[model samples]
Target: MKKFLIHIPLLVLSTTFTFISCTSSKNVDTNLPKDIAERPADEDSQKYEQAQLDKLKASIESESSREKCANASEWTFAPMGAKACGGPQQYIAFPKKMETTLLPRIEEYTQKVKAFNEKYNIVSDCMMIMPPTSVKCINGKAQLITAEQ
Candidate 1:
């Protein structure tokens, strides 16, 4: 009887401690950043990726500009940017001579842009980019034109 009385208090204290511990609030780590980039790489990587893509685009454009478009036959158009909804975002004009070099890079760029769009869940206008009907050489640069133009 005497030992039971001593153990009753111990049991009550242990139960009370368990309840108190169970009810105690714990800190949850919420890594919320202000004005954060939509990407997981978070900051510099996105900018670097975009910049590299832009640089490649600029280089490809430079390749097409190496010669005057005196002959429209010497020029052709390639699709650019893989749109989310389907079709290319735009068309690029390149010299037929540079086709061997430019086509692969253009394909690479398109693939990368497609990946970026998919990765970042980038939304784009669903308007389908119709292929240019013909290449036009107004002055020196090659231009893509529709049948109406």
Candidate 2:
């Protein structure tokens, strides 16, 4: 019974110590003294922060430009089945508006592409070209010629 009582006090002390050790204290300046030195902002840190802000602004501008491109009444040409050359080429607008919406315009273009593919006796040397409103299938591929040259 004596040993148990002694151990109980020791256990309480250890628990109190553990609690004290685990408790996080924030060092806050409650009493502001006039003579306390105000820490100056580092020049390098300021420059880094400004650079990050500039990058963020640039990114925002880029995103806005892309949104404008996507929403604009512009036509995009794609080759029928050419893996590299047959995707959304560029923003082209016809003299007349195709439709009021983007989806219909894309669908119309897709049909045209399918027809072009069937009509043209295309080989690996075929190139899709954009001259404003129409997609032209040229005889030779630009990439192949460039590589050869």
Candidate 3:
């Protein structure tokens, strides 16, 4: 009877641990977007492109600061590494009525960046950094939602 009581507690403890381990092992999938899985694998290329992006962003910030446009929003492209760098990234939005006045300048700046990348042969296989055409604003910041087809 004494031996049975001691074994009962041990059995309960082992059963509890087994149940906890089994339940914890089943992780829920968040179901992220397909584009996230398709990012560039080349670390060197990603770094080079990110530098070009930073320069373009600086130009845009200088230009925007002068205009002081209210509620001005733009779609910005970011490589996986750029998100880790702390600074304002340049975003180019298309010709929407809300941002019509800024479109021409943005377009010119984007073209310059494109030219620089071409001159230096800094390119990426990933579509996100290769000139994304569509974006969605999340948490008051533009996120690349789609790549150019």
Candidate 4:
């Protein structure tokens, strides 16, 4: 009886201590800047972003046979009048199943492309006009567009 009473207090104290320890919160430093770097800072990041933007612009406006188009992750958009376009960069012709979703997105995509092009001074030497080609899907592991024969 005495031994049990003594152990009960000790067990209760230990459990209470453990519970408090487990439930206690520690101060977390969440004020640190996410993308901040020391030397090649925001400027470098912007430059890299611009470079990628330029590449996207190029892929969108590519005309030559050597310039192959890449595939998009979810939905592909090939420009209406281009030979082929790259992923997210090239606007794809809508298939039967994709028309409903993609048709509306085309205008928005155009606006975005125009804005990005204008901001980056992407020359519209090969802007698509009319008669969109087949859409190649990225999900198929075949991520490149084959020009129409």
After superposition, candidate 4 runs with Cα above 4 Å error? 1-30, 38-93, 123-148
Question: Residue by residue across 1-149, what tens digits does model 3's lDDT show?
Answer: 99999999999999999999998878755464469546545645656665766776666555434432233254333322221122212344432443545555556555555655565665454433454566665454444554543
The sequence of per-residue lDDT tens digits that candidate 1 reaches over residues 35-120 is: 46643563446667877778988888787788798999988898987888878978998888888888999999999898877877
**What RMSD does model 1 have?**
8.4
Candidate 2's C-alpha runs over 4 A off are 25-88, 92-129, 134-149
lDDT of 2 by residue, 13-118 (tens): 9999888776643354656555535544465454444454445434433432333232222433222222123543334332123334433544454454444444
Predicted model with the maximum lDDT: 1
lDDT of each: 0.83, 0.41, 0.51, 0.48
Q: Judge candidate 4 at residue 39 and give its lDDT.
A: 34
How do all the candidates rank in terms of lDDT, highest first?
1, 3, 4, 2
Residue 4 lDDT (model 2): 98
Better of 1 and 2 by TM-score: 1
Clashing pairs in 2: none
Decoy 2 TM-score against native: 0.22
Q: Is candidate 3 or candidate 4 better by lDDT?
A: 3
Residue 17 of candidate 3: its Cα lDDT? 100
RMSD of each: 8.4, 19.2, 15.8, 15.2
TM for every model, in the order presented, reads: 0.68, 0.22, 0.30, 0.31
- Pairwise TM-score winner, candidates 1 and 3: 1
lDDT tens digits, residue span 19-112, model 4:
8887674444556566646334454354665665456545533422222334444434455222223223354433334546545555454555
